[model samples]
Target: MTVKEIREKSNAELLNDIETLKAELFNLRFQQATGQLTNPARMREIKKSIARIKTVMTERELSNQD
Candidate 1:
């Protein structure tokens, strides 16, 4: 998802998305370890998405604290 899309979600939704992504990441790692992964690049995408979500979350938190 793009930053705009990510930013549109509520905090609860963002947290849920993060949990889902983390689960997917774990499964992808397992596939990689067993030589079953078809798309290794997905791992990179997922990591970046997680980072983006966290960045947005932090931004919101800081804004709220002000």
Candidate 2:
């Protein structure tokens, strides 16, 4: 999801999504290890999505602190 959409989601939803994305990432890594992964670029996209989720979570935490 885009950062804007990620930001709009409630904290609970974001947390849940993070878990789901992490599970997908784990599967992607397994596919890569087995050389069964198609579209290698998808790995990068998934990594970026994880980063975006983390970045948004950090931003929310900083905002809460303020």
Candidate 3:
């Protein structure tokens, strides 16, 4: 997901997305550990998306405090 799309989501939606991403990440890791992962690139993409969502969430939190 793009940062623009993430930025447009409400805080609750972002939180939900984060939870979903975390679960997916965990599953990906498990697959990798078993040497059954078909696409290693997906792991990187998910991590970056999670980071983007987190960065946007932090920005919103900081803005609210100002």
Candidate 4:
């Protein structure tokens, strides 16, 4: 997800997305372990997306503390 898209979502939605992405990441890792992964690049994409979401979440938290 793009930063703009992530920023547009509510905190609840972002949290849900994070949980879902984490589950997918776990599944992808399992597939890799079994040599069944068709797209290893997806793992990287998911990680980056998770980072982007967390960054936005932190930004919001810090702004709120001001």
Ranking by lDDT: 4, 1, 3, 2
Candidate 1 vs candidate 2: which has greater lDDT? 1
Clashing residue pairs in candidate 3 are: none
TM-score (all chains, Cα) for each model: 0.99, 0.89, 0.95, 0.99
How many pairs of residues collide in each model? 0, 0, 0, 0
* Regions of model 2 farther than 4 Å from truth: none
Task: Give per-residue CA lDDT, model 2, range 1-66, as digits (tens).
Answer: 799999899889988988888898889899999999887887788789889988998998999998
Give lDDT for model 3. Answer: 0.93
> What 10-residue stretch in candidate 2 is worst by lDDT?
38-47
Q: Candidates' lDDT values, in order? A: 0.98, 0.88, 0.93, 0.99
Error of 1 at 31 (Å): 0.2
1 versus 3: better lDDT goes to: 1
Candidate 1, superposed: residue stretches over 4 Å from native: none
TM-score, candidate number 1: 0.99
Cα lDDT tens digits for candidate 4, 23-42: 99999999999999999999
Worst 10-residue lDDT window for candidate 4 reads: 1-10
Query: Which candidate gets the maximum lDDT versus the true structure?
Result: 4
- Compare candidates 2 and 3 on TM-score and give the better one: 3
